[model samples]
Target chain A: MRWIRETGPVVGAITLALGVGAIVTALTGYSVPQVFRHLAVGAFGDWYRLAQTLTQATPIIFTSLSFLIAFRAGLFNIGAEGQLYMGAFFAAWAGFSFQLPPVLHPIVCLLFGAAAGAVWGFIPGWLRAKRGANEFVTTMMLSYVAINFTSWLVAPGGPFHGTAWANQTVRIATSAQFPRLLRGAQLSWGLIVGVLVAFLVWYLLFRTPRGYELRAVGQNPLAAEYGGINVTRNMILALTLAGALAGMGGAAETLGTHRRFIELFSPGYGWDGIAGGLIARAHPLGAILAAVMMGALRAGGQAVDRAGVAPADLAAVIQGLVILFVVAPELIRYFRRLVRRKKLGDIEL
Target chain B: MEILSFNLFISALRLATPIALVALGETYSERAGVINVGVEGMALAGALTTAVVAYFTGWPWLALIAAIGVGALLGALHAVWSVYLRADHVVSGAAINLLVLGFALFLTRVIWGWRGTSPSAPTMNAWILVGVGLFLIGLSQVYIFRTPWGLRLRVVGEHPRAADTAGINVYRTRLAYTVLNGALCGLAGAFLFNNLGRFTDGMVGGRGFIGIAAMVVGNYRPLPALAAAYLFGFVDALQMRLQDYIPSQFSLMLPYFLTVIVLAGFLGKAQVPKALGKPYVKEQG
Candidate 1:
């Protein structure tokens, strides 16, 4: 019953968002039913499509987990995007620079990437914890800085620029790459790692003493402090962990999917993580399903575009609408009040 | 010496116009106890409106009006979500940003056969808008500080229950200021269109967020906010010149990095409104 109660709003929001997508598609002179059909077909049309969807879901799983952990500790780590970029670049650097055995190489690259992301996360965490800075602004500003900084590093004349005309590093060594899960499919062991990490997060969040303290801080920081938990330390820990999660995701993308750090490759996976975390009500286990749902939308969106049914951008509209509806369940209550013709006042949930 | 010439000052003012306008708008909304992080989306929507309208109608003035209307509409929607529905303000604002980006891109592709750009359209002089922005900032300093209405706005934000007891309409005041904030963002977008003579998806870039940074740096005051925008604008101008000596990527980073440093410097010192981000409820007798 509690699970249903918590999940009811998210389910309702998804349905309504799809309805809005239909309307927008019709208004844009596309066949609404065809768009929906294509969306379904594109997402689960065949084994190949399913593999592609899972491939797309892999990175978001990491990012949403990053957001989930931070949100549980009352922090918003919007810098996940930047952290991901840093991780990707560093992972790529490690991939090409070393001559290690196959099993050892990927591990070293992942650690280097995670460390870079952790450092980035630590800066804002320290600032918020020690200097009383708002993590919201600092995280956002740092995202832009990291993006530009990484872009410069890979552009022509930079230290890591590849010989290729494209703005990307040289292909990472094969030994550093994650083994493909299926022949003739882009799916890699990265997805398996992401799932394992999700299980780890669920255990950490629900079955650990540290998790209790973190949630207590999120619920009421002053109360947590009075209860002897170090609120500041927890805040720093949450963001640093969040950064590590996102960084590992970036490293995975480079090693498992792209095989190199491509410039401006992310199509807002970090932002998608926010929506995914919210859709899951911040449950670590639920994030996997939410990520897969988002992946379906992206994959289906691309299919629709290819079929000329509708632009892929419609997925974004649906996503934004989902966030709006989820955050404002009061909208439903307001309509209910209007139906009853009652004067506006707070209604008990 | 060439980099520090009179042209730099002129260019700085031009670059500062949008940021100043956005800061001024944010000052009004934040002063009235609303945190509208959707300002970035509002400006983008405004820019899109100007391009779409101007492309079809060939009337710059009409396009400008449409842009402002679209911005205000988005603002009003945000107000409905954040203010009336008691949603998380940042979450609602993020939604607006995403929705507008999707809408803008969809419209561009549908109408122009391009993903995010439109052909050059007839545009009015952006400097005129800059001049008007300066005047309004000057007037706002007085309007926000000296007027009874301004005091009412402040009172509503600081202590809404008291303001309610005093017969002020707290909800209405919040709604009105948020709408005004949206309109100002629209004007900023229009200025961008006029300056560039067209529109691209990335035209607004990070200026909207930078504008919020300016507002914080200004301590939520109009005149000081404009000054903060100008300072950012000057750095922006200087960075363009420095691009020759350094990598453009590093040069591009200066403004964002500076914003982080400046915000870190100002965080706890800024006088935040007491009722900011809280949903006010009327008690029954």
Candidate 2:
């Protein structure tokens, strides 16, 4: 019952988006039911499909929670893409360059990833906290810096170049790789760790004094300040924490899946995470389910193209619409109310 | 003597054209108490519209008018949702950004049957557009500071209640300016492709976002924002020239790095309009 109530709006949003998608599919001269059937089968047809879906979900779960934390503090950290790149790059660099005990190697690499992301995150947080800079613009500008700088770093003949022709770093040491969870499958402990982080974030936000201060700052900063909470400090702390989570996600993706940092490592996973946060309404634990839903869409995106059902970019369109509906639920409600009024009077519909 | 070269000056103006128009548009909307991050999307859509019109008809002026129409339509969509429903300003902007991006990319395949770029179209003389943009900025400065309509718009941003009490329709004023802002952004988009002579994927290249930063760095005023746009444009041109002396990446990062430094140093002193980003409830107003 609780789950139903919590996901009520998300379900409505998905339904609306699918309705729009169906219309689009029809316009392309395809059967909507067949397209959806293929989508479901492609995302969850077998054990292999399930693993692919979960793999697609893990990183977004991490970044969505990152957005969730910053959002709860009334700060928008849209720079998750930049932080993810920093995290992935540094983690891969540490994984390849370091000589450590097998067990310690992965841990050190992951830590470096989080630290790099934190530094990236902290810049905008500090600017917003100490100065009055809007993180929206500052973080965005820095994202280009991150993208171009990373591109240059990995370009052939550039620093951090590996032995390959591709613009990427050397492969990580075997000891640094995440242990696979299943035989013949790429699934690893990374998915479990992602879910665990969600729970931990929930505990931190709801059951701790510092979390209370963060929420207070988010809810009413002037009131929080008047009540003796250090609003400025909490704002910076929340954003930094958010960045750390995104960094961890990037590390998990690099260490668990690719085992190296490559150019265009993310297929806009950061933006997908932003959509996840909105779908979850900034709830930490809820981000897990939202991430999986997004993952299925991503998997379905490929399926539709392969099956000749629709364009591969249909997922992007649907995700965008889902964000629209979720961010402004009132838009749906207002339309619904108008429909009801019309039905009660002249029955316009 | 070389620093004052006519070629360098022209290149700087060329680089600054899109950023200048976007910054001016952002300044207007922000002053009207609406934050429209959709400038990025609007600009992209406008560019595509320009490319399509220019490619098929070879009429650059028609493309300009069409781009403004597209921008206004998008701006109206934002205004209606934000003004009436009081949607979360930033979130709504992000939604528009996402939807417009996907929609524009999807249209490329449908219209041109090409992959990521449009066919190179003929470009017209763009010096007239740059002159028009500079003239508009100057005119807007005077109109905003010295005109009665401009005072009403500022009052709506700074104090909606005062504007309401003074018989000004705050909602209508905000909606009007927001639509106008979109038109300006559309103009900026048209300039981008017209100057470049073609449309490429991701051609806006985050200039829409950079323009927003410039508006803030300039204290959200048109004159200062125009100067900020030129400064950013100068860095872009300087970076290209510095490629011979330094690693190109370092040069590439100059504008962004400088923007951050400039923002950090200036933001604390910059005061946004008081009612900015807040939805004005009719009762409260």
Candidate 3:
């Protein structure tokens, strides 16, 4: 029943994307059906394709969950992108610089990544909660700084520049790398871990008193403080946890794929997760579905490119439309209200 | 030494123009009570439109006008989402950025047959636009703080109920400012690319957000924001000139790092307008 209600808006967004894509296809003299057919086959044509989708979806799940938590706490933690970079960098530093024993190496690296991310998250949280700084601007600035910082660190003669000159760190040891789940595909065990983390987030949000405080603060900080909730502390905690989650995403990506930290590693997975959380209405479990859908679209874009119909950027357009279309219901309702006000002959709308 | 200093100062002003214009626009919106997070996306859209139109038409001036028009439309789209739909301001803004990015790329491919970069067009000596933007910034100080209309807008932003009770149209004021905000952002972006002679992906490079940072540092005031933009422009220009002295990436990171520092240190000192993000609904008497 819940899904039935949600499907209307979700379907509306999908329909709008498909409708627009079809119009463009028809105008450009391409087969609309063929484009879609390739889209499906590209996303799920074989086990390898499915694995690739899962591989892409893993980071999104973590980042979406991160956004979901902070958003639920009424704080916009736009610093997830920066936090993810820190996480990946710390994880890589641990993997390459340390000579830990085989069993403990990956675990320590992941932990270091989470800690780095949490510290990054905490600063903006502290500023926003205590100093009245806007997270929107701070996070945006921090992201550029972090990206460039990483670039500098990986540059020649800098701290962690690899021999390849590609602005990357050296590959991690075998024990520190995430084990693959499939024979030939790059799918890692991180996919399962990401799903487990999703479950943990669901439990934390719905079944914990700390979660109650965060939600209360988000809903009404004044009322929550009146009710004895530490609003400032809760806001900070919310951001810290969110940063930790996003950092783990970066960790998972490095441990799972690439096996090393690279500058500009993410193609906006952190930002895309914002769209994922919105599409899922901040539901923890629902984010997995949203992430996978986005991953499929990305895969479909590759297929479209291979088919010579459109560029891979069409995927970005679909993601963009998903966000724009998600708001379509509200737009329609607003217009309807305007019409009703006009019918009543009211001077103001 | 004098010639070098003059060249650097001129380059700084040129670099600062877009930031100042966008910050001024954002000041108008925030005073009327909206943060207008779509500034970056709006700027990106304007850049693309300006580049494409100039490329094909041989008229860089028309491109400038068309860019502002497109930016205003995008801003209006955001206004509709924010004002009428009563959506979360940040959410709407983020979505607008996402939409514009995809839409801009799509348009880029359609117009230029390439998604990476557009061909160079005729450069409009943008120093004139810079002068005009600065003049407008000076004029807006009076327009916002000294005029009766500006007073009403301020009241609506600070206390919409009070403004509404006093017979002011809070929604219209905010909607108008938000659109104007978009126009300035459009001008900022158009100016950035017009002088550069082409559009490339990621060319806006977070300048839109830096404009927001400038507004915060300036306490939502025009003169302060212009000054802040100049400071930032100076840092950016110095970094460009110091490419051999420091790692290029480190030099490039200075503006973002400094903005963060300014924001962190001035967190409490700088004040935002009250009722900035709240949606106003008329209560039944």
Candidate 4:
């Protein structure tokens, strides 16, 4: 009953968003029913589509977890995109540069990715904690810097540029790549790892004394400080942990899916993760489900493209509307107040 | 001497126009205790409107007005969410950004059979807008600092309860300034469209964020904010020239890096309004 009450608004927002998308589709001279049918078929029609949906769901799960942990600590780590890129690049670099045994190779590369992301996260964290800088702007700025820095590394004359004509690194060794779970689908062990990490994050955020301190800081920093919680250290720790999580996501993408560090690889997965975290109301377990929903929308958008129903961007429209509706639940409360006021006036008359 | 030529100076001023306009607009909104990070999306929406209207009507002035109208509409939406609905300002702004991007992409694909780019359209003189922006910034300095209404605006943001006690309408002031901010962002978009005579989704890029940075560097004052915009504009112009000697990617990172550094140095020191980002709840009798 509690779960249903909490998710009631989320469900309503999703339904409203889809309704808005349908209206948009109709206005654009497309059949709404056909477009939605294709969306459903594309997202869950068969094993292959289901695999694709899970595959898409994998990275966002990591990023959403990243957003959630930082949010719980009273910080916004929007720099997951940059951290992911750094992690992916380093993970790929490790994959191609060294020759090691099968199990150990991927493990080392993942560690390298996480370490790099931690370093990236630490800079803005330290700045915010020590120097009174705004993390929101700093994280965004650092994201642009990381993107450009990585792009330069893969461009024609950079050291990491592979012999391939495309601006991508050489493919990782077979020993470093993640084994595929399905015979003909893109799904890999990354999904399993992502789920495990989500559970771990839930435990850390809810079942630990440290987690309590962090939540206290988010709730009231001055009070937390007076209560003997080191607000600065917690802020730094939260962003660092957030970075590591996003870094692992990037590493998983490199090891399990891409097999190479491609230029400009992310399609705003970081931004999608922000929406995911909010949709889940910062709950770790709920983030996984929200991420899957986002992934399904993406998969369905691709399907819409193939079926010639409408442009794929229609999916983004629904996602945005969902965010707008979810964030403004107060709008509903305001309407309720207005109705009550009208009733009071009628009674007076 | 070769790098700081007359052309570079002129180009710097031109590049500074949009940032300065956004900074000026943000100054107003922030002064009224509302943070409007949706400037990026508002600008993009404005540019898209300019292209569509200009393409159909071939009237640049009408396109500019439409851009402003669309921007004001988005601003009104944001005000409703943040002020009345009491949503998080940043989240509401982020939603507007995402919504605008999706709508821009969809419209482009639907109308022009292109995903993100619009064809060349009829345009007016972009420098005219630049001149107008500079003029507004100058006038705003006087209006904000040397007028009776300016004191009321400051009081509303700094001590809203007091302002309300003094019979000033806090909610109306905030709504008006947010809408004004959005209209200014639209004008910035119109300038971009006029300068290029075309529109692309990525054209606005991070200029809007940088504009906010300039506002901080300027200490929330209009004239100083314009000066900060000019400094960033100079770096942008210099980077374009330096692109011949260095990788464009490395040069592109300079402005963002400088913004972070500049913001880090200036954030805590800025005279931030006392009631910034806090929703004022009126006590019912």
TM-scores for chain B, listed for all candidates: 0.98, 0.95, 0.96, 0.98
A73 in model 3: Cα distance from truth in Å? 1.2
Docking class of 3: medium
Q: Can you list the residue pairs that collide in candidate 3?
A: none
Q: Per-residue lDDT for A1-349 in model 2, tens only?
A: 9877667767777788888877876785668888788788888998887888888898999889988899899998787887888888888988988888887888888888889888888989999999877887777777778877887888876888786779888899998888877777777777988999999999999999998999999999999999999988998998898788888888888888889988778877777777888899899988999999888888877787788766656666777788877887776777667878978885544
Model 1: per-residue Cα lDDT over A203-268, one tens digit each: 988899999988888888999999999999999988888888888889989999999988888988
Which scores greater on lDDT, model 3 or model 4? 4
CAPRI verdict (incorrect, acceptable, medium, high) for model 2: medium
- Give the per-residue lDDT of model 4 (tens digit) for B1-285: 588899998999999999999999889988998888889889999999999999999999999999999989988888888888888787788778878988888889999989989999999999899999999999999998999888888888899999999999999999988999999999999999998999899888778888988998899899999999999898888999999889999999888888888887777788998998788899888
In candidate 3 chain A, where is summed lDDT lowest over 10 consecutive residues?
A327-336
Instruction: Evaluate all candidate structures by whole-model CA lDDT and list the values in order.
Output: 0.87, 0.83, 0.84, 0.88
Winning candidate number (DockQ): 4
lDDT of 4 by residue, A1-349 (tens): 9988678778877887898888988988988998899888899899999889888888899888988898898888878888888888999999999999999999998888888778788888888898777676777778888889888888899888985688889999999988999998879988988899999999999999999988899889999999999999999999988888888888899999999898899988877877888888788999999989988988988998898888888888888898888878786555556788898875632
TM-score of candidate 2 chain B vs. the reference: 0.95
Ten contiguous residues minimizing lDDT sum, candidate 1 chain B: B90-99
Clashes found in each candidate (C-alpha, N, C closer than 3 A): 0, 0, 0, 0
TM-score between predicted and true chain B, model 4: 0.98
Interface RMSD of each: 1.3, 1.6, 1.8, 1.1
Model 1 per-residue lDDT tens digits across residues B1-285: 678999999999999999999999989998888988889889999998999899899999999999999989988998888888888787777678877887877778888878888889999888899999999999999988899999999998899999999999999999999999999999999999999998898888778889998998898899999999999999998999999999999998898888888887777888988998788888887
